[model samples]
Target: MGEPNEVAFRLTRRHSSVPRARAMLHAALGDWSVGQDALDESELVLSELVTNALRVRVPGDRQVGVRILLLPDERLVRLEVSDAGAGKPQIQHPCEDETGGRGLMLVEALAHRWGVEERVGGIGKTVWAELKAQFVVPAPAPPVEVPAAMVRPGQCVRVWGCWRTALGVRGDLDADGALHVVIELDEGPPLRVRSREPLTVREAGTPAAHEAAEPTPG
Candidate 1:
């Protein structure tokens, strides 16, 4: 039963998109033959994980994401909360009066099983949880087809073949030479990135490529 029966998303859990997540979940899992209670539980799990990721940011930084993966057979759904940090979540049972300290506990009670695993790029981790549902969710909507060589705006993108180098040059400069690395991804959303670290601008396509390095401050 180790088939690739899974759908996962990799979005940053930033402050934005919090309100829309619920509806998105419904859109993703609405067709499945699952109970409303199960859907509620899954949404709760996603919120818990996504909130934890959001808390990682300080006064600065934007929102990240929590991806809901509908397992094959539509029998189970996987919730993965990813972040840009090195840490694992622990489940704690708090007292009745405790206002907090009971998120993971809720997940523990709701999910069939949950655990954490390292992410692919060797940066963060994915807090995974599974809920029973039996989603014979009809054949997944036919994938929106597009020519291989074309990657428009608003699409989930990943860069494949690429190379990067670190060159050091000092002296502060204005936005004169600064360049905005914007890629038009046709499908998901436009990536609006403003950062201080090395940026990675990528688009959808075979052998996808991304430019490394973030925009520096003036």
Candidate 2:
């Protein structure tokens, strides 16, 4: 959407920090408009990193640090988890009989690329991963204008502050013979507008509106 942004937080070194880390990562990536699949993968990667960070032999008072960055232009998302532990994390290949030591394996499979680096203060290490981001672009604005009377089913109209498909339209004359137009939308309730009121509408098959055209009223 706009420029890239970063979010950082610290979590207590405990088993509870795993889900909390995932929640914060989800919130940050969701705000960046990341796709569902990417969000899922990113959360899994973060969970593994945080879990490994928690297992590090650090002091009780030392906390785990997490950082998330989204680069819209590059279509990339980066995750980092740091701990004040002594040793570096290495990917392990455990036998089938072993039920553990698979965290890094999952990270390697899910992330685009991953590695470790020494913490800035040199007291600990930071595990980082980068994942491809799926960003959905908004549809373009409507170009063609259609009059309310000419509006037909399967067309798109901007009413109630949203773009909705036109389900049906009809005009009725009141006791005074003043014409009132009723337009039905695919979502929400119908709309009733006076014949003279302005309406925002677009023909079918436009970029902003991709509804299949229906037969016009006889």
Candidate 3:
């Protein structure tokens, strides 16, 4: 059986933090099998939530934070942002050129459901959103057979990709963003990488793209 379907990521304000969040999500959830529409929606939500935290943070204390949770069995994913500022965020339908508004409204229009609440007994507040989907798991692939010589270095085949968790890609990203990739390709400890943002794989390389796998799982 697979491990628990719940995972959490906590972070402070940093330039690379947002992309790390996205990459971590993609890794933990097994390639984000999300379709074109869903993928676009998820990315937009992440952007809005993170950007809000950045813009409205308390300057003196500088303790702004973000958390992402995925509840796969329940068919929902949640994004939450918490900051020292106690001001309640409103989802205003602002005019086209309102100096600084429209974040919450965009979230409301996109999320299946979203709301704001006090952070338990805390001083800050958490603006959050939840999205649900009729997500389906892919059928397991049949085995492959090939010559040992064809496999090369640094290759990530599906069988291998499934079990590995990566924090980030080494060369793909610039200084602004990083990734926190987690995979379950095997029963190994989840890898927590801090990587530069690389171009996301529209499709992971082909079977022949990288090194071939050993006959058995790593």
Instruction: Write one digit per residue (lDDT tens) for candidate 3, span 1-218.
Output: 32325446565677676787667656644454544465556667877787777676576546555666565565666777777677887877767777767777778888989888888877778888887644545643333443222222333323434512222222223366653333322345533333321211212333333333443323
lDDT of each: 0.57, 0.84, 0.56
- What lDDT score goes with residue 218 in model 2? 17
Any runs in candidate 1 off by more than 4 Å, and if so which?
Answer: 1-16, 58-63, 134-218
lDDT of 2 by residue, 96-213 (tens): 9999999999999999999999999668989999999997655655544455677778877777555788899999788898897788888887877676565666665567444334
Task: Name the better of 1 and 3 by lDDT.
Answer: 1
- By TM-score rank, best first, the candidates go 2, 3, 1
Q: Model 2, which residues run further than 4 Å from truth?
A: 1-3, 138-198, 201-218
- Which ten residues in a row are the worst by lDDT in model 1? 162-171
Error of 1 at 155 (Å): 39
lDDT score for residue 98 of model 3: 77
Clash pairs (backbone) in predicted model 2: none
